[model samples]
Target: MSMTNRLKVDRRDGKLVMAHFYVAFISLAIGGLAGLLQVLVRSGMFVLPAGIGYYQLLTLHGVVLALVLTTYFIMGFQIAAVSRTSGTLTSKQRKIGWTGFVIMTIGTILAAVMILLNEATVLYTFYAPLQAHSIFYIGLTLVIVGSWLGSAVILLKYRQWRKENHKQTSPLITFMAVVNSIMWIVATIGVAATVLLQLLPWSLGLVETINVGVSRTLFWYFGHPLVYFWLLPAYMAWYVIIPKIIGAKIFSDSLARFSFILFLLFSIPVGFHHQLMEPGIDASWKFIQVVLTFLVIIPSLMTAFSLFATFESYGRSKGAKGLFGWFKKLPWKDARFVVPFIGMVAFIPGGAGGIINASNQMNQVVHNTIWVTGHFHLTVATAVLLTFFGISYWLIPHLTGRTLTKAMNNLAITQGILWAVGMTFMSGAMHAAGLLGAPRRSSFSEYGGASIAAEWIPYQVAQAVGGSILFLSIILMLYIIINLAFFAPKGEQDFPIGEIAETAEKTPKILENWKIWIGITVLLILFAYTIPFIDMFHHAPPGSKGYKLW
Candidate 1:
């Protein structure tokens, strides 16, 4: 059957997907504005208005953009991808999705209100002994719960499809989506345990103090994988959508599935790499996690190879002349391809920084520094955000029956370039300044006018300029999306789903063995975390009293 026919049958699911995108864009607007304020404040060029402070804005920016925007967008994108590739969601599944969305939206509103009112300046991590209102933690808990519910729905549909199809391999997009959902469920258990068992009780005064080290351990347990959660949806586009956009098939279906499975197993256990700088965690355990972190990189490397091969083969098929000449044969003018391609390029540095941060020796130099900030911007901000922006150009039009105009397409390409240029200036300066001992999460000027402090001023100025450019780029992007959603002419659009290349071997049956993969993932997590967690509880210091520095 045609995609249009399938979409017609799944019209209700499309509306749910649109709702998710709507919320995501709203988050981008609010968070993007907060980002501008942050750069200006950090540059020491502009003071915040009365009743608004740096930490508050920082918390708002982190929560909205990092947590809210990524979660909503991924859910929407995954649902759409699954529906398009597998089959329409059942009415029950749609209801489950909507229920989760409503719960999450309410939770976000409650948490956002707390932040805006200066009652929750704990930052997105919300680590103790810095405390916020009980409602703040409660709201975030609800958000996690909602997401879990939604994930359950997706899993149910996937299981149903497997039952009906019997021995057939799952559709690649659907397979990827299910893997991500399972990963999310596994990852969130850490945060949920910490919040419901530790933080929430303390916040509600049911407990007198909080286990600062234990809470942080749990947070990071979820924290690093949280990045992977944000990233995998973008990977879905790169693997499945980008090849199609480039007039090529996926290089290897088996490899793509294996990579996601690797992510499922390796992504969570590596969170201890984030805690290398902290005490209480043993060095041996940290070293083990560092090794696991490197293991996770293998899948990404495989993806890189596969993508390059796809491009090379496609170029050769198109009659390209030389080794590097194939680069020019790519569909660069297509915003759908160019935007995400740039995002993929940005990940080169971002992934490199991640490796540095994971290393025990190198992390000391960059931990709590602006270098970490630069690293994430290159990653989540540029790589992940730009991919979503690229996806949006087609996704919005696809769902809304709107034609993406040529002018809007050009504007999107321009937006992607501006973002890349801006991030280069901003993150590059941040990295340089961090190397010279500049701190992150501060809004200070002139470290008492020390000579070394003076060295940071030029980089700070560059950060401000770059941030302004990024803000402007986001504004243009929003304008384009708004037009596409509400004002563009109604029309049908192709939803790109790359095929497996004819030259590639059939996907291995071992790749589809979910039972084995899940078991191995569970075992790895147990091996990595069980002993450390037991040690933490057994030897833990007295819980710390809460503080409200803001």
Candidate 2:
């Protein structure tokens, strides 16, 4: 191609990209630090003097990192998807998207500051009766509104692409973006409703006392699906980006579609799984949520088997033999491949724990303990974070039109190992501690009075060591990304799969239509949630003496 005819890539430079990544990394780094600190405080290795600092950090770490990092990079990934498939975005769309990011960042910062100043220490859930500063609610509103706008910009451009390529079905990446938009539209409603009706009124003192049970029901109504919101993007990275980099088609595109559909349908009604420990709700209602929870597991298991089968198929194509021997044939040296691969390996055990948590009997034992935190951290922080890390490494070269240095690649691999190893140790310790009845969110425990101080001491110490290794992994990742962004050579490099440009001809549409599934999702959600929600309305105030805890 002539110089003038050569396609130009959209540069991920400018102040916006810089600002987004900077805020994202800082938030995540702080969150990672807080994780270690919590483990330390709980393990009795270090004393945490009672005050607002620990709680505020914990609160800020959970809410900010959960909201900011996930959404910010979902926008970034949208950009990558569009660029790879459609060349570049119009200047107008890019500005709107980044503007939304800026608003979200400021909102996140405001909320963080409020917590740090001890104005909002009610934990991540803005559950009723425990009101925050006006600024905290205001900040949260801004964050939600900003994310909506970001989703709008991405989806608008995606739809425009669809219009031009009438025959083409949405690419899996773009389909995920679409699903994310739809999910958010449904998912944010409960929290938004709670913020407006319950939290805002309570915070402003317009209400003398809010119904805590009703508020919690609504908050978690928005809460559980919010987890799927964090996870869908990670799964998108696995389904779309990984296969592209590894030179394989997705093993079962139909299965991938089912996974997304299942998420849309089941994620909403299962929120009561979090409420198993609380009293007041009818056992029958909780039992319904529990059954739906197990039903939801079918999709997760299907996903696990499908992705594993995808890897097996790839290995077989490369002339590998034996059942699990395909694991060795994977591109282990490539950070993009290895990080997510390791993440999935860790997710298997952690996910099983999640299944256990969904059970009424198992949940009663582990609820409000270190075990809950450990299970989720393993699934969310470790699994989702590793997937995002791999996606960043996988896409950064294309985004910058440069290949990362070999040294950077090696650093990434080493960090992935450390991250996985650290999580295994930490989560394993947490499981034991939870079984021993160690409480979460408490800084210390008196060992002698009804507690085994001697036995608890060693577990706490192991947690600290594990946490230290985790912190080191974060530092290593920061160093590698910084090096890749600044020092790596810039210019075209073959992406192994070929240059990631939109194919010139339109491809045929297969299963991209959304209506049938959306209808099913609506029906499934109603079927799953209708009885429990109705029962909540008919039941007496949850704290009545007749109410009982499981």
Candidate 3:
């Protein structure tokens, strides 16, 4: 068995992975604090002291948690998974890994420092016309560029593995990492183009005006896939790690690979669904992209089905009977299983909400409302973020040469429960207020004491209540992580990677054909966006100069 399959990452490699978790955990602390402040301000029950601006906090929270935390964690997690499943990186590959880590850390610090100075108030979306400082844009560009460098390490390692083991399947976790890396490289081209060509020039004052429609077009093009970038890693945990934690096998390796392929093919071409309400784009193109957007539901549902199967199969093997009895057979006491399980259950509703947002008519109802905010909170915050926490519970200890003691496991479970409870209060209120016409991205207001505005106040307070609980959870999370990293008893905690079940069919060779998959992914992107991309220039109104309202 490989060293990784034997439940330990090489010590040299562990340091690299630990570096990433450090940044990710720090981001959680900074971002989580900003989030609490935002909620408090929105509730109209508190006021900012001195010169602190609401949008500044909003920008900090969005960029740090959404972009910084997710990217660092994913990159680190993928690197470690690839190293474990494939083999420890060679000295050259390890050097490349450290290089990427350095560049990414530099970029993160630059961007974060700018935000702290209040020079950049643009939120995570980086939407145009709401301009931030040139350094901020440059910093973010470096962040993207640094990630590309990190992705290169994964590709190089995978290529090396392929050369060494001809006619053999790649390790499952390593293969999934490659798929995600390829998708990210392809998807970020849109954002990179806009940043290097348009936004950078404009923000630097070399250009007087910026094209809003075209910029937004490029952003959402990258934006929607950006969602999957965050999601696919969580899916990785669900498909590979969760089953192992429960002592079950993967229901089907082929199903898992196919689902990931479907994600790569269908995820990028559907960004137009986000632009349905915007003008200057043809309705026909929007309709096409919307249809493509719905196609994404297939792989998502496949994942759901596969997880259910894994659970059911394991339960049956353990003597579970009746239709729903299998659910009772899961390891409820295991923090590794239970923490991610909450995230899985949260995705059911989180995903349904996504389908609604994609529908054109439905998009109009929720677009830019607190409903949209609420929707993502459930999806990314509860569904995605909580799972990251769960992964950390095991991963941090695993890398640090320690084990999860029962007391710490209990605390980890409490952290997840707190997150769920907090999100319910916060996101549920935001959804309700949104349906009643509360706009998002605005500070507390009675709108000249308007009757309609009065109705949203209660919901705002509820969000504050939830936000407070979430902050408490964050504190607990950090404490638990510190313990795991430094104070845990010296022992081995298994790095769980699920094995394929005996009855599973052989994975078809076609699934690994990168030429065919990338060819299709590229073609679909062109089909969905080529015309709109060109037409945006022709149909766009005059561009606007940068604004700094904050």
TM-score of each: 0.97, 0.89, 0.97
> Model 3 off-target regions past 4 Å?
1-6, 446-448, 540-550
lDDT agreement with native, every candidate: 0.88, 0.72, 0.88
**Rank ordering of all candidates by TM-score, starting from the highest:** 3, 1, 2
Cα lDDT for residue 276, model 3? 85
Give the Å error, residue 368, model 3.
0.7
Query: Could you give candidate 1's per-residue lDDT for residues 1-550 as a string of tens digits?
Result: 4321154426788899999999999999999999899888777788898869889999999999999999999999988888887778888888999999999898899899999999899998888888888888888988998898778777877887788788888889889989999999999999988888887887788887666677888898899899999999999999999999999999999999999999999999998898888877888999999999999889999999999999999899899888887899999899999999999999999999999999989999999999999998999999999999999999888888888889999999999999999899899989998898898877744363567768788888899999999999999999998998999899976788998998888888888788999999999999998998888777755443322222
Residue 495 of candidate 3: its Cα lDDT? 82
Q: What tens digits encode model 2's per-residue C-alpha lDDT throughout 242-299?
A: 7767776665656666677778777887778899887656787778777877776777
The residue pairs found clashing in candidate 3 are none
CA error at residue 498 for candidate 2, angstroms: 10
RMSD of each: 2.1, 4.3, 2.1
How do the residues 1-550 of candidate 3 rate in per-residue lDDT, one tens digit apiece?
3423435777888898899889999999999999999999988888888889888899999999989999999998998888878888778888888888888888888888888898888888878777778888788888888889889889998898888888888888888999999999998998988888888888888887767777888888889989999999999999999999999999999999999999999989888898888888899999999999999999999999999999999999899999989889999999889988998998888899899999999989998899989998998898898889889999888999899999999999999899989999999999999998898888784352677778898999999999999999999999999999999999998788899999999988898899999999989988888888788766555444322222
Clashes of 1: 0
